[model samples]
Each structure stands twice: as structure tokens, then as C-alpha cells.
Target chain A: MKRVGLKDVAAEAGVSVTTVSHILNNVQGKRINAETRRLVLEVAEHLGYQPNDLARGLRLRRSNTVGFVSDEIATTPHAGQIIRGAQEAAAQNGLMLLMLNTGNDRDLEDKEIALLLRHQVDGVLYASMYHRVVEVPQRLASVPTVLLDARSDDPAVPSVVPDEEQGGRTATRELLAHGHRRIGFVNNIDDIPASRGRLAGYRGELAEAGIDFDPSLVVTEDSVAAGGYRGSRTLLGLDDPPTALFCFNDRMAMGAYRAASEAGLAIPADLSVIGFDNQELISENLFPALTTVALPHYEMGARAIFHLQQVIDRAEPLGAAVHEVLHCPLISRDSVARPRT
Target chain B: MKRVGLKDVAAEAGVSVTTVSHILNNVQGKRINAETRRLVLEVAEHLGYQPNDLARGLRLRRSNTVGFVSDEIATTPHAGQIIRGAQEAAAQNGLMLLMLNTGNDRDLEDKEIALLLRHQVDGVLYASMYHRVVEVPQRLASVPTVLLDARSDDPAVPSVVPDEEQGGRTATRELLAHGHRRIGFVNNIDDIPASRGRLAGYRGELAEAGIDFDPSLVVTEDSVAAGGYRGSRTLLGLDDPPTALFCFNDRMAMGAYRAASEAGLAIPADLSVIGFDNQELISENLFPALTTVALPHYEMGARAIFHLQQVIDRAEPLGAAVHEVLHCPLISRDSVARPRT
Candidate 1:
């Protein structure tokens, strides 16, 4: 079958081929009417007139594709939301994602980035599965790049990451609003942004509420269930046990649940608990579903693509890099309640 | 800096441009020495030589890319493993994945498929997050396509899916081997392939064990934690409650755990429980952990790419389509134990 062309669609729609091309290509600053655009698109769809992307890319020196290079995306649960957000945003601009996974291998990442450049991708979304600091690949210097769920020390590369401090404040405020003055915080021991920012937020929120920051009430441990269990046990054994607990993440909350259950304390009624990183599997399934703060994983992804497009549209790197911090909203469930005291 | 070309690598390696091109492009049938191939690759890497894939693709009429169109990959936790598997396999063959996600919208799917076809993709991988029967898209008929974790009624379209029945049997047999004569099956109410196949496996395994299939022991409900809890509660409430339970998935098993806990039956001691779909978040984080059947998500993804490559390399669809059913492996965790009879 002879492939349908723009001329076929133009003839079918009774419009000029240039009108069809302008509307379909989505050329900026065009003065075409909306009705004509719709008619051309409808006719093009009905006629199955697929624009030859390869030919168009070669002619224009643009692939209409973006490179999505991530380190270990497949192993993380958060991968789905981030990738989905980026892909959806990219699709809105008629761009496809050329997906590659590096498995955190530096050498492999270099090769993959080179391959992406070889494909003539208009830009690259250098994504990380989790929010952290990353040294952008050296090869990406030649192309427009945006970081998703990650940042670099250099101020010249754009990035988008969740506001971990705000997320912690959101979680802490939820517990504080429940009229609990003495709240325990089960924090991760890592010195990463999440740990440091969350701790700062916790302290800052408590100060606003006029609650003295009690060093004895805070315990740091590994950010796993076992660690949460151990930390919760120690906190509960204190001379003046906290009426509420703020867990670092949902996994830690799951451990706290077990700890509370073992100590014969009912959730919300006996001990209010709040967690961060509302991982649905843990937050939703736990008995008395956990009240937690959510990471802006999806937003970070979408915004990364938006930022990359901005750079690509400019056809040059911005004089100053744009670093975006997205808000982490509170997800209230059954785990938080007013303290009896 | 000017873009490095094939001639640069050839000059650095003291080889002809033809040898470099053949080695770099991996053109088969030319017996190039292994040492010279390594030398060319090293020189190419050191010189940062990047092949112009666009020109190469245009010349060869091959994109060296596979279109990966999944129905809602980002919403499901299973998306990561499947994509990783396919991507890793593709990378091994020097191919890249052009990813597009259609959130199960038919019109959007049609448009996306058209876009993929226009890119001159060598083939397409139509993937589903879960195992199901799918009607191959009409537009996909023109391209070499393979189904991942899905199958079509037409045997001519290649597919790869998990052996759902075998997974069920594995879970049931684990309970039986632990000396549990009567076991409860908490199955999903949906009339999908997983529900039917798992139920059939339960009955088949019982028959093999010379035990009459007790219709009263099986309860169907939603495949969520609440459903699992309700189903388990009902089964445990029976006058002659089974000593063991097999849940449809990890989420359901989490519910089963709650029911057991409420009934004062310790896991692996008084009530042995087994689940399917080894979702790490649910299974690993659940108290007492969870022994479950792992759906070969990664394997299915890798195999799908392998199958697509076979069809593509053959330059034609095989006379007989290959429908491969990979085995579901048993992951032994802390859940199952011998009955206290």
C-alpha cells in the first residue's frame, strides 16, 4: 500500500498541504484557525496519514525524541510514576522517549549517553529513581539535559527534586495538629538530603509549636522495617513515652505498627503515627492505613521534561540553571488522631 | 569540538574505514579478527566516535530500535522488571527501545501506534502490566510484533506469559508438603485468566494429592488486601477451618495475615500461608515476610525482546508463532510451616 501523505490529507480536507503541515507539525507562531487545525488532524487520522518522523527528523535535524536515561529505574517502585509523568508530558509535545537504563554503571552510562547523542535526540532527561545528588554525565554537556528526582553541585544544569524538608514539615504538622506536644521521630541515620532536610523540618515545626526539641525523643536508625522496630521499641520504653510518632518512611511506619501492636497500643487511639513517602503498598495496606507525606515523584518527572523542552526550544543552555522544588502533600488516613492527654 | 566520525577511529586504529564500519555497526558475515575488533572499539571509545544512527538507518532502511508500547506501564509496580528485562536484552543486541505509554485509551493507542510505525521501528513490543488476553491492534499487523505478559486468540502472533496454573500449584503444593491436608484458597473474583488458571491449579493439585476438592474451602473476592482479609476470615470461620491458606497475590496475602493475627493464629505456626506475585514491597515488608510465587515478569520482558528479534532477523514472521509459558518460581520466605496437627 502506498503510504498516505500530507497532500492526501490536504486534498481530503480541502485545505492546502502547507496548512496540513503547519497544523500537524505544530509549528509555533502560526496564525492558522482552530477549526482548520481540527479538520486537518481529523482528516489525517481518518486517512491514516502518518508523518514520516525519520525523514522529517533528517530534514530538520531533530528526531522529535528525548533520551530518558535513568540509573536503576526498574528496581524501584517509584520508577513507574516518574517515567509515566515524563512520558505523558513528552507525548503532549509530540516527543517519544528513547528509554535507557544504566544500572548505576558509570562506564555503561557513558556508552548509553553517547548512543543517545548518536540518535540526535533533541534533549535528555537524566532521571534518578530516587531523589539524591548526582554528578551529571560528562557527555551530556553537549546536549540539553534536565535532571529528574536529582540535582548536581554545578548550578548550570537544571534539576527538579522533591522538597524533603517540606514533606517532613507536612508530616510533623499533621501530628502536631492532633494536639500532641510530645512526639517521637524515627529518623534514618543516613546523612543524605532526605535525612538532613527531614530532621531540620521536624525541628523547625516543633519550634513553631513552642514544643522544646527533645534530643531523647529522636532516634536514628537504618531506614528499613527492622530499624524502625528497634527505634520504636526504644522510644516506647522511655520514661515519658511520646503520645505520637513520626516515621521516616512508610516502611518504617510498617515497623512502628508492629512495635505498637506488640506493645498493646492501638493506632490513633493510643498512639498517633505519621510517615513520609506514602508508598501505597505499605501506607494503604497497614491496618488503620498510615497517614503520611507523599514525595512529588510524578511532578518532578513532568517538570523535568518541561524544563528540558525549555532548554531545547531556546536552542542553547540558559545563562542560569533552573532548579525546581516540588511540594509534598499530606495524605491523611486512619493513623493520626487527637491525643487523649 | 567537531563530531568524531568513522574515519577518525579508523585512522587512530590504523584500519580501513570499511573495517571500522563493519566492526562498529556489527555487520555480520565478515570474519574480522577479535583483537582488531577490540582495537577498533577501544579507539572509537577513546576518540568519542559516535555513529550517525540517522544516516545509517536511512541507508540501511533499519532504525535498530524496537517500539515498546505498554498499556499503563507506569501505574503498576510490575512495570519496572518487565521494562528492565526487555531493555537490558535490547541493549545487549545494540538496539534501543522507543517507549510509548497508552493509558488504555483506544484512540490514543491508535495514534501512538501510528507514530511508532512512522518512526520506521524494526518491530514493536506490545506489553501489558499483568497477564491477560489481548486483541492485537490492527495497525500492528504491518509490523513484527510480540506480546509481553499477554496473549492473543490468533496463534500466529507470538506471545510470552507466566504459567499461572503452575504458580497456583506451586503455592498449594508448598502448603501440602508442609503437612497441611486441608487448605483454603483465597481467589480473586475476576473471571480473568489468572483467577481461572489459579483455581484450576488448586483443584488439580488437590486431585493429585488424592484429596477431594472441597468447594467450601475456596472463596473468591476482590484481589486486594481487604478482600483477602474477608475471604480468609470467612474460611477461618468455617466449622472445619483449613489449617493453611493460599492467597491470589501478595496484597491478598497481606489481608490473610491480618485475619490470622486477629484470630490469634501465629504465622507459620498455627496457620501456614502462601501467596503469589512476589511484590517485594508487600511481601518483603509484611510481618513474618511472605512466601510467594514470583511471576516471571523480568523473564517475560527479556523473552519478548528475544522473540521480536527472532521475527525481525528472520525478515518475516515465523510460519508457526511461538507462545512461550515461562515457569513461576517459588520464593521461600518466612510464611509457610508445618501444620500443628
Candidate 2:
């Protein structure tokens, strides 16, 4: 069936196409009487007229279009929630999203951002797979932009990222509350922000618990299953192995579980363990389901879209760039318990 | 910095906008001289003119745009790879995608499709998360449409879907080759096509191995971690438990691991297990790593977009609807092993 247009609505309502456009598009509606406005709207609704968004978008200075640029996010299972949340939030505000998946190629990203600008997207969301500092692309300055799950060195650009330090504290505290001391930390390298912040939280919790920091109990590893396994082995092989361990993320924690299993130590009963990044795929399925801190990818994505809208509406508002550090709440499951004293 | 337009290139090339449009937009090379074409192209490259895709799209009978409509496929992690493949394939063809995520609301989907129709999308890809028959939206008839990972009652519409029966057979064969005579099957309900096909494959593999069909060996359960756990418990509680188990999916396989652990059986040592859907998040991280059949979500997606382009280009070819059943290849890991003699 042919799509209903302004002409069809006008013919049905016995009015001029300009009158229908003026009333339906809300352009110069003062001249249109209420009865005429009602008649035009009723006819348009009955005919199912879909006003050309691009034409109206130009007149209203609102494209009703948002551009989403991501690096390998579309393929990551754990992070797909971010897109889902952003889509829902965009729809609630009458916006349609056109997504560009760049797969982390800087040149492709540059081209994609340039294309989005050419489209005159109302706003742009640059999302990354993890919390890291990214160099701001010069071309992104042309539109209202926000970073999701990533931050920028340029303090002027706004970012919505997870509070990793808080997550570390939450995970460590859960172990502490389980009557554990001499806790081990299977950490990522210190070069990244997450490691530095999480390590600080780990140290702070240890100090608060009156447990002196033990350099022997910590092992640095890459953020993968093999890294977690190796890290766990190093910690378990220590002369004085800690009663519990806090892994940097869930994937690492899976490796830790392997180490514990290899050593003939049962979870919770023999050695308690806590993890971060509650990726449901691993955390929910792991034997004795893992207790870990959540990343809030969905919330961060929703908040960024909401913030981008605010950024777009502002007219030279004076304030510091918004840096939202949303909470990474602890999800308690079967992974934590009291140490065997 | 201002975005360069056709007008900027026209003035720089010392030619009319129509001439610049003809060369830059590839309107008609025969009408314009080669020198003028070369000068206009050189000036366009130097001025960094970004051609208006919408306007040029009209002359070429191509919108340079494809519409992707999904019913919660964007939300489900298992299906996100589908979008990833489609995006990459679309980009390779110089077609940008405008996605509509309806979250499975039929009314919202109807409206979203109406919007896409109004935009004059070159073609449409209607994707579903599961392998099931869906009613083709009446409005989709106007555009060249292809179903991704979904089928329709009307045979005229083409679809690209996974071969679930083959997947089931592949998983069971992997277990049988490991020297298992009694293999247990944990399946989903029979109403779904996947379940029915997989069960047939399971029986097919067992029959090929010269084993009698044991009705007591199979248990139908929900496709989740809890379901796998429950199904495993029922199988193991038998007077003589099977040495091997084949789970419907990775999530169910996880529960199988839990059941083995509780029963004091080591994976691939005493109770060998095989799974379907190599969801890396679960399969890779599972204690022994799961061996399962892989769903060709990415290939299905990529193929659908490529097929839609074919359907769009074909000039009224008469034939039966194309129904492509893709292979679900097996990913060997550490899950399967020889049973105790």
C-alpha cells in the first residue's frame, strides 16, 4: 500500500495541503482554528499519514536522529545491553538511531563520525567496550557528543563511565564481611585507570579492616581466562596463601575457579572468592554462581543519551564538563562465604 | 570547520552546480567532457566535498540505505553477532543501515516499518532471535525484503536460518565418537522447530552408532542453567546413569557441570558432557570448557543482506522462495571424553 501523505490527508479533510501541513507539522498553528486543527489531525490519524521526518526535522532544527558509534560493542554479548538501553531511551524521546559499528579501526571511526556529521545527526554517542581514556577526534566537535563506557583526556568532553574503585571496594568488602583477612588480589596491570582505582579500593578496604597490606598475595595478570588461571596459581602457590581472592573481572575470576579446582579446594567451603564485572553469561552459569560487582553498561548508556539531549538543548551554558561516575553495585550470589578458620 | 557541499565544489571548479552535480554525482559522464569531469573531480577532492547521499541516491535508484528491523535480537547477546555481520556486509556494499529495534512489540514494529517505508529504504531485513515462523508484515511487500534467522508462512519471501537438526547431530556424534554407547539428551520442548530437529538428529546419530533408542534417556526441560541442572539430576538419578550427556545449549551445559560436581563426577573424567551453541562467554569459561555446535548467526546475517541485494537487483525472476539452511559447525573443546568401560 502507498504511504499516506499530506495531500491524502488534505483531500480527506477537504482542506488545502498547506493547511494540513501547517496544522500537523505545528508550523503557524495560531492561524488554524481548533475545529480545523482537530479535523486535520483526525483525518491524518484516520489516513495514517506519516509526516516526512526529514522535512519537518529541517524546519524544527531537530533531526529526530541520533548517531551511535561503537568499537566492537555490537559483537560483545555482555555489552549489547548498552545498545538495548540506548535504543529504548531514544525511542521514548521520539528519536530514531542510526548505528555505525566501527570495530575499533580509528580510520573507519573517523570516516563513520564524518558521515554522521554529514547527516547532521542531532547528537552522537561514542561507546567503547571498556573503561579507558580515548583521544578525542577533532571532527566529533561538530555535534553534541558523549562518551559511553569510555572517557577522554580532553576535560571539556563529557563522559559516563563505571565507578571501578567503588566496585573494587564493594567486592573486597563483601569478602571482608565474610570474615576473611590476608585477602589476595588478582589484578590487571596498573597502566589502566580501572587497575589503579580498583587497587586503591582494595588497599583502602584492607587498611579499614586492620589487615596490613601483603605484597606477597597480589599477582598482576592480563584480563582473560588464562591470565586469571595463572594469577590464581601464583597466589595459591604462595608460602602464605590468602584465605580469599578478589579478581579484577569475571573472566579472570573464571581462571581463579580453575586454579581452585585444580588444587582440590572447593569454593566458599575451603577458599572464598569474589569477582568484579557481573557478566551474566559467566557469573550466572559458573558452578556455585559467582558474586561480582556489576558494570552498569545499560544505565551508563541510558544516562549518556539523556545527557546528550541536555547538551544539545543548552545555549552556551557555562559549567564544568559533566563526568558521571555511576555506581557498580554488588550482586551477591553463591561465590562468597566465611573463611575456614 | 564547515562541511564542504556541492556548491563549494561548483564555485571552485568554475562551473555550474548542475555540471558539478553531473561529474561528482556521476550523473552522466557522456554529457560532460573528460577534462571538465577531471577538473570537477580534482576540485571536489581538494575542497573535501562530501556528496549529499540522499540527493545522489535518487538519481541512482539506490538510497545507499538498508533498513534492519529486529524483534529483541539487538537485546539478546546470542544474536548480536547477526547485527555485527550485517553491518560489516552492508558497509562493504557501500550501504548504510538504519536499524529499528522494536523490543518485540508488534504495534511498535508496525509503526517502525511504516517509518522505514516513508524513508524509502532500498530493502528491508526482518530478523528474529529464535528460529520460528513469523507473519510477514503486509507493509513489507512494497520493499525487497529478506528474513534473517526467521521464516514466514508465505513461501515467496526468502529466509536464512541455522540447521538445528544438523547441530544436534553434530553434538551427539562428537559424544558417540568418544566411545559412548549410552548418551543422554537434555532437550527443549517439541513445539519449537529447533527442539524437534535437534531431537531427530540426536536419534539419527545414536541409530548410526548401532544403539537402540532409549526413551528413558531423554528429558525435556526449559532452556536455562536451572533446566540443565534439573535435567542432569534426573538422568544421573537413574539406576544406571549414562556416562555422557548432551545439553541443548551452553547455559544448559553449565547446569550439567553443576550436577556433575554435586554428584562427585569430574568433567570428561567420569561424566562426559557436550553442549550446543558455543556462547564463548559460557562455553569458554566453563570449568573444562564446553564442546558444542556453533550457530552461524553472523554468516546468516551477512548472507541475508547480500541476498536482499540480489533480490533487489533481479528483474522479476520467477522461482520458488529461497530457504537457505546453514551449517551449525562443531567447536571442539575439553567437554567430551571416552566413557568408563
On DockQ, the candidate that comes out on top is 1
State each model's TM-score restricted to chain B.
0.89, 0.95
Looking at model 1, residue B109 earns an lDDT score of 95
Q: Tell me, what's the RMSD of every candidate? A: 5.4, 3.5
**What overall lDDT, based on C-alpha atoms, would model 2 receive against the true structure?**
0.83
- The lDDT of each candidate is 0.91, 0.83
C-alpha displacement of A49 in model 1, angstroms? 6.1
Q: Quote the positional error of residue B246 for candidate 2 in Å.
A: 1.2
Top lDDT model: 1
Q: Give the residue spans of candidate 2 off by over 4 A.
A: A1-49, A58-62, A314-320, B7-23, B29-47, B57-62, B136-142, B314-319
Which 10 consecutive residues of model 2 chain B have the lowest summed lDDT? B52-61
Write candidate 2's Cα lDDT for A13-85 as tens digits. 9999988888887875258878999999999888867666555554565657788888886556755678777
DockQ of each: 0.52, 0.42
Q: Write the per-residue lDDT of candidate 1 for residues B104-205, one digit (tens) a residue.
A: 999999998988888989899999888899988999987899999999998999999999999989999999998899999999999988999999889999
For the record, the alpha-carbon RMSD of candidate 1 to the native fold, in angstroms, is 5.4
